[model samples]
Target: MRLASLSLRYKILDFLYKVYPEAVEELTIIHVFYEYHTVDDIKKHLNYLVDKGYIEQKEICLRLGTKKTTNIYKITSKGIDLMQGIIQDKAIPIPEDE
Candidate 1:
């Protein structure tokens, strides 16, 4: 079954936050481990993060008698702030819902 966009987004966040510091590649086998079928879905979430200023992207072209485009991704300061917020929020004790 396909994962929800929210789940995918969190998985992405966890990946970038803990697993891979350099999660720049357009296609990653590790994404499949996180239940991503293709790069398009992952790219969609990455674009959303970029639009929200939680991340940044850089385009690098390869020349080998042909042009190849690759996207390089990096978590921005805003993303680090977001992560810290999440950590703090999780640290606070809250009553469990019955």
Candidate 2:
């Protein structure tokens, strides 16, 4: 993992650790924490985490008489290991521009 990934991973793990089982919007995460990250970038990183088996996404439907759906993210034990420095990281990277 690069520093950029590590940073985002840390932030996300911290967030999910603080609010497990509760859904949070990607926009809300960008607005509140990763101010410099775009939704696309965040989504890409999340996809990476998913591919790496560090987190899981739950697609839920709303019951407002509509077909609306929401994507809620949750961290896995592997992700917690990485966040806690149990997983080795690779080269360092910088924060990207939105």
Using all chains and alpha carbons, the TM-scores for the candidates as numbered come to 0.64, 0.69
Each model's lDDT? 0.59, 0.65
- The residue-by-residue lDDT of candidate 2 on 1-98, one tens digit each, is 45665677556666775676565665566666557666776787777767777778777775677898877778788766665667744521223341
lDDT of 1: 0.59
**Runs in model 1 lying further than 4 Å from the true structure:** 1-3, 19-23, 29-38, 63-66, 86-98
Q: After superposition, how far is residue 15 of candidate 1 from its true place, in Å?
A: 1.1
Evaluated at residue 27, the lDDT of candidate 1 is 56
List pairs with backbone clashes in candidate 1: none
Predicted candidate 1 versus true structure: per-residue lDDT over 6-89, tens digit per residue = 556555655566644675555552355445345676777778877877677887776666689777777777666666664322
